[model samples]
Structures are given as C-alpha cells and as structure tokens.
Target: MDFARPLPEYLIKRYQGWRATTYSENKGWYRRLADEGQRPRAMVISCCDSRVHVTAIFGADSGEFFIHRNVANLVPPYEPDGDHHGTSAAVEYAVCSLKVSHVIVLGHSGCGGVQGCYDMCEGKAPELEEKTSFVGRWMDILRPGYEALDTGDDSVRVAELEKRAVLVSLENLWTFPFVREAVEGGTLSLHGLWTHIGEGGLEAFDPASKRFMPV
Candidate 1:
C-alpha cells in the first residue's frame, strides 16, 4: 500500500495550478455542486482512452455528465448472477437512481480494445482466447459484433468493427430490464456515437437508416 501513497510531483503541481486558476474561476459553481450533489442529465459510456474526454467533447461543465469508461465502451448482456459487473452497475445506478434521461455509447476510431477483439476473432491472438485473461474475457463481449461484421480488408474490417462496438453496446443496454422499461415508457433514450480522432469529425448512428451519418 505504500506504493499508493502520494500524488506525483507533476500532478501535485497541476492540482495547485487548478486550485489557483480553473477552480478559482469556478469557485461558486464548485461550491454549489458540492452542496447539491451531482444530478447529471446524461450518462456517457466511453472508451478508457485518455483522448476520449466526454466533458471536452460536449464542452460540459462540472457534474453535467455521469461518465463510465471501459476497454471499448462495451456493455455486456444483462446478467444477475450476483457477480461483479462494473458497467452494468453503473448503468443501473444511472437509470434507477440518478434517472438519467439519456445513455450514450461513445465509440471511437482506432480503439485498441476493438482492435484486440478483431485480432482475437481473426485468430491472430491466441493468448486472448484464454479465459484467465481479464482483457480477453472483457473483449469477448464484442465477439458478437465482430461476427456480425462483413469480412473485408483489415482497415475496413476494423473500422466497421468500431461502429459495431457502439451498436452492440446500445443493444446490450436494452438487455437491462430497467433500461428497456424506461426506453419503452419514453422516459429514457439510447444513443450511439463514433469519433474520428485525427479528422476531428463525429458520426452518429441513425437507428432508422442503420447508417452512421456525419454529425
């Protein structure tokens, strides 16, 4: 536990800088949030990549979003076997407790997790096939997405797989009975988003057209 002792020197300096500037500039907002607690309207499920900043993408203020991040922003099929399910737990709290109106699955290009799933499905990653591997087991949730993708060149396949990750997560979100009930009752909505990092372009999935159109 000693290894987990203190903040790094650089991070400590950064914290001081924030307390002096950013936090100071928003001192009233920060105080109000601390007193009122968070009441985010949306829950954004995104990849764990440092580049996928949910707040920055929306220009969101503090406490505007309840965000959850995983390997590929994946949500596994609903299971209530009294097991550990991090994403599902977040979804449940967001829906049943916080009553977030929208749940967005934010996928992105060049997702390392999606690439790993593609590689695993393509038989290029034998080590990932083992059940003991945490990442392997987690990436397995996207196997169905990969299977449902049409075969093509590596680049095309991976890109499609990235989109599929969003689609599959959206589908899985519905498997949570609470989420489905809320959606059916018109109290909640589901959204899929994909970002092209280098191009700085965004695409939104239209369920009706079954296409990802530029946003």
Candidate 2:
C-alpha cells in the first residue's frame, strides 16, 4: 500500500524494453499523429474503473479514440454553475472540436459505483449522508432508474437498474447542444455498449431491438 514507493525495478525495465518495441512498430503512426494532431474516428465515454480500459478493450493506439472516464459512466445534463464540468468539457471537445463520427457510452458489469447507487435507492446505506461525499451526489443521477424498478428479486432489480442507468445516460447525452446538433445532422451517432468483465464479452444496445445483444 506504499504508493509513494517507486515502481519495481523488474517492471520498470520491462516497460523500458517495450517502449523501444512499441516505438519501432508504430513509428509512422506516431510521427503522423504528432505532426497532424489526433483525429480519432470515435469517442468513448466509460467508467473510471481500472479493469475497464477504453483503449485496451477497443485495441486502440494513440490518436485512435477520444476517451472520457467518469464514475458509472454517467453523463449529467448540461449545467452552467461555473463548476468544473470535466465530462461535459470532454464531450464538447469530442463532438465539436474532434468531430468524431461516433460517441459510445460503455457500461460494464460488476461496477461498484452502480451498485452503490442501487444500494442508496434501496435505503440500504442510510449513513451515506454522514460523509457528505461527492459520490453520493453523483449516484443520485441513477435515482430514477432505481425508482422505476419494482422487482422482488434483489439480483434482478440490480441488473435492471444498471441497464436502465445506461439508457438514462444515453438520453442525458442529448442535453448537450453540440451532441444534439451533431446527432441531428447525421455527423455523430450515439452507441451504448455493456461489457461483462468476467467473460470479456460485450453487448451492444440496439434501438430497433430495444435490448442489448451480444456483439
């Protein structure tokens, strides 16, 4: 748990060895990306979980995908409170500045933050108010999803809540003017993807089918 300690010597050396190989293998790409700047074809909004890596999951190298990671991959509706809108800023940059053709919201199974939201909705964590933490406020975004669930089985309710939250985020994405305009103009499309971390598989949301299907 000693975070202040430097990386292990063996790991450091291994990374150093890979650096040369990576540079050699991607020399042209690196040179072009650096000179021309990044023009990624897609932008991915995902959860800030160590296990959920956007680049690694999509097999992307530098300048491939613009990424924004936040807790539970939640996208709050546009607000102007002179606050630090990290995720909103990234979305604006991706849609307006980068002009990415597609914006994907990636949700994953076994998400702790999502579970916390579910717990809060069920009144299982009453002491959360004592902490006055930002997570509590952020998790409130899923309140509607939790309230909409009327199931008896706890597991089923949690699963439905998670899926509903993703759908809610998709709706929230349109709250941004840039995202809405691009989608209406056919320049940008929104996609929702659910990843099962244990099995390393993905389910893509199908608007036509009204469900998530294996990808």
Candidate 3:
C-alpha cells in the first residue's frame, strides 16, 4: 500500500502549466461542471493506448464525453456472474445511470493490442496463449475477430483486425438488455470509428455498407 511515487518532472510541469493557463481560463466552466455534476451525452469506449487521445481527437470539453479505455477497445458479452467486469460496469453506468444517448467504439491503426492478438493467434507469441496471462484472456474477446480475418496477407491483416475490434465491441454492446432496450426505443445509438494514426485521418463504420468511410 506504500508504493506510491511522484509523477515525472515533465508531467508535473505540464499539469502545473495547464492549471495556470487552461484551468485558470476555464475556471467558471470547471466550477459549473463540479456543481451540476457530469451528464455527458456520449460514452466513448477506446483503447488504453497512450497515442489514442479521445478528448483531444474529438475536441471534446471536460464533461462532454464519458470515456472508458481497455486493451483493444473490446466489450465482452454480458455475463452477470457477480464477478469483476470493468468494461461492462462502465457501459451499465453510462447507459443506465448516465443515460448517454450515444456509445462510440474507437479503434486506431498500429494498435499494439490488436497486433498482440494477431501474434497470439498466429502462434507467434506463446506467452499470450497461456491461461494465466491477463492480457491474453482479455485479448481473447477479439479472438473471434482474429479468426474471421483473412490471415493470408499478414501485412494488411492487422489493420483489418483493428477495424473488427470496433465492430466486435459494437456488436457486443447490443447484447446488453439495457442497451438493446434503449436502441429499440430510439433512445440510444452505437457508433464505430477507426483512426489512421499519424495520417490525421478518421473513418466511420457504416453498418449498412459494412465498410469504413472517411469522416
């Protein structure tokens, strides 16, 4: 319990600068959010990758989006086993409590999690195949996606699997009764997004088209 450590000097300086400038400039707005509590209309489920900045990418304000990050941006099927389920818990809170109108699953290129799934599926990473590996078990949610992909062309397969990550999460989100009820009642909507990292390009998945289009 005594393993806490100070943040790096650079990050500390960055936080101080934000507090001095950005936070100072938006003090009223910040205080208002604190007073009223957050009622974000949108919930974004994204990867835990450091490169994927949900707020900065969407230019969202402090209380605009309720975001959850996990390896590969996956949403597993609803299982009421009274066990720990972080992503499901977040989704339940967002949909039931927050009443978020929209849920977005965001994926990105060159995702290490997706790549790790690929390696594990292809028998390249033996450690990930072990049952005790947390990441491997978590990444297993995307194993169906890995199997559905055409692995003949290894170069393009990773990118394809990344898109599937978004798709899979969207599909799994519907399995929740609350989500299904909201969607059927026209109260909630699901969106999928895949970003072309380093290229400044974004693609939105069209369910009807079953393809991603530039946004």
Candidate topping TM-score: 1
RMSD of each: 0.8, 2.6, 1.0
> What is the model-wide C-alpha lDDT for candidate 3?
0.94
Off by over 4 Å in 3: none
| Runs of candidate 1 exceeding 4 Å displacement | none
> Any idea what lDDT model 1 has?
0.94
Q: How many Å off is the CA of 148 in candidate 1?
A: 1.0
| Order of models, best lDDT first | 3, 1, 2
Return whichever of 1 and 2 wins on lDDT. 1
Could you give candidate 3's per-residue lDDT for residues 90-197 as a string of tens digits? 999999999999999999999999999999999999999999999999999998898898747896999899999999899899899999999999999999999987
List residue ranges in candidate 2 displaced over 4 A.
Answer: 1-11
Error of 3 at 31 (Å): 0.3
Q: Compared with the true structure, what per-residue lDDT tens digits does model 2 show for residues 65-90?
A: 99899889988888878999888889
- Per-residue C-alpha lDDT of model 1 across residues 170-194, encoded as one tens digit per residue: 9999889999999999999999999
Each candidate structure's TM-score, on Cα atoms with residue i matched to residue i, is 0.98, 0.90, 0.97
